[model samples]
Target: MVSGTVLLLLTVLSVCGKAAAERKLVYVTVLFRHGDRSPVKAYPTDPYQENDWPQGFGQLSQEGMRQHFDLGQFLRNRYKGFLNESYDRHEISVRSTDYDRTLMSAEANLAGLYPPSGRQVFNPNLPWQPIPVHTVPQSEERLLSFPLGDCPRYKQLMNETEHTEEFLNVTKTYKDIIDLVRNKTGLNKTNVESVWSVYDTLFCESRHNMSAPDWVTPELMEKLRILKDFGFRVMFGVYKQQDKSRLQGGMLLGEIVKNLSTMADAESKKQLKFMMLSAHDTTVAALQASLNVFNGRQPPYASCQIFELYKDDNGSASVSMFYRNNSKADAYQLQLPGCALDCPLEDFVKITKLSISDDRDKECQLPSEGRDKEVIISLAVSGCLLIFLIALLLGVICWQKEPVSSRGYHHVINREVGEES
Candidate 1:
């Protein structure tokens, strides 16, 4: 009896160990919007100047720095065993936007994430230890530096796509905004109204409690407020017309999906545990717009979105999205439209159809049944129309073929002539 019990215990322990080993270490990719800042733009009539903010416009304040530091501490706590007590170059990598605000915020976050340890530690008199964060120039950052703040190509895309049905519908729906922009900036007879920029300006203005522009009447402000709330809808609201999405937003998604495929292809080379991007709210907006996962409100300071890909014991992969904003009490768990929270890697690539958005993906958008559904629906509609026309023609011919009594035909013809006369 004693021998049998010992053997059973050993077998059980072996099974447990094997099961644990089957699961791979978790991988995380985080894309974060920069923290709070002074307004990106100043209205011509506003009293606030560049010096009004201690750091000036488009700069992160002390509060922003503190928020990111706290966020870093949160990450350290959450990923304790996953990360070493001291930073390990092999295990982790960090990338950031080239802008000063983002670069500074990343540094502050790193300070909290790693702190100081061992001989690498600095003097005890200092408040914090130094940690290095890696970054490339804005021009070279393919992952985070998008639309490059105010890119001409992006502007061109937006302008060209404005004529599409979706853009026209959004324009017609917000027809009142043209006059409001004219009144605020005092630029008369403007031809362009970027729905995105308008919403962003209003959201920022409302948040700061700035005086409403003279052109913005109470009714108009209300409409703008609603438009502000609909930013997320405009991004992924599944509008009937899809052609307009080929603009900058589409370009942004195309890049991300291509990157994902490249990463997947190189799986045999090494484990890509995480991809971190230091970016702005606009970058976050573009990505979320593609994934159909955006909240209507602006992404707040130091907002961090996490994408987790799980490799099951059997080698199957799944993904889930987690969004943490400074303003919110808890992170949001995104439920994608067609896929589950833990979506299969294959399903992920399948849903984010490429080349449909851009010509750059000629080879990647391999012909597939899923890609042809819209064309099939259009063809079905055309076939139905043709069948209806043929049936109507046949009915007319049958009526004409009826050998009506000569008297009946003559009477009908006479009636038609009388009416015409």
Candidate 2:
């Protein structure tokens, strides 16, 4: 009897496992960096200038287009039946930063994702059809850009980060290398924050097989590479990573989580299936930092961070993340720090709460500096007093300048008497 009962329980457990495996994909959000591009800017002594590039500085190259196209094809294969075979504006949304390269990359990606078919085809000669990739002005781009310039709190955090023990140690250890870059690259400033620019320009030049300066030896290149990676960590990780993420990457992560949570509702399941965000490498790093799973290396060109939401037969939803940094390799599955690879939505949200900010503006406001607040108050009081005295002096001067009017009857009588005489 006991054996029969045990066999029945085993059969029930096998059925439950199968049901879990059949969870339906409810939604997906993908954030990817632009493909290869010309250097953003070159140092004063650099060999390659802006004019050397085909489209000048910061424009995406032909290889970049290919990278994004391949990414789109990969997405199409992954979401074969989940998404429509043709482009549907209602089902998917694409947002990109307001930069030429990112905008172009998004368009190229769309071409591979939704090749025109049947009525969707506008012209036979071209397989591509125009798809909207929306963007806001660069100044207002908080959704996809990291190390946001407008967040004063984030700036304060960065400033404090520079003073931390880890930061000081890094600076002290790499002092010689930093000095070499400053002197050789003709960069006015060379610190942990700015050293990455030199690395970036050199890395891009090397990729294009352009000759680098004699100073950039292989050993030097390796050191610059390490510093560049460290620069990324300093930007989004290193000290108080969660707080930094809340102010930088957490902003984007919060929106993505909200969207996923909304789609988890059965009523909203069909409303939207896919969301594509085209942004920078820093943006990807920030989000990964917030998730506490960043690999601490620079995200490569066309790198993609993907979030997939699935609902099991039991009506519970889970979120899964993947990072595709290399086109030649499979995307790495990222597990939320305290959860499984497929984390329950509730647990995911709870674990990520510390990184999300409800009021970004409030959080960005740094506490008043030690003595600066007193100085500001003193200056403000003095200025107010100065203004008050100036107004009083002006009032007196106006009164003194006015001519006193003679009494009407006395003035008229005196004038008449003088005329008669």
List the candidate 1 regions with Cα displacement exceeding 4 Å: 1-25, 139-142, 146-181, 184-222, 229-272, 355-421
lDDT of 2 by residue, 1-421 (tens): 9999999999999998888678989899999999999999999999789999999999999999999999999999989999999988888999999999999999999999999999998899999999999999998887888888887778878889999999999899999999999999887889988898999999888888999888889998898889999999999989889989889899998999899889998677366899999989998899999889999999999999999999987789999999999998878899999999999999999999889999988888876764588999999999999999999999999888876663233333457557532
Tell me the TM-score of model 1.
0.65
Clashes of each: 1, 0
lDDT of 1 at 311: 65
Which residue pairs overlap in candidate 2's backbone?
none
> What TM-score does each of the candidates earn?
0.65, 0.85
Against the hidden true structure, what lDDT does model 1 obtain?
Answer: 0.64
Q: Could you say which candidate leads in TM-score? A: 2
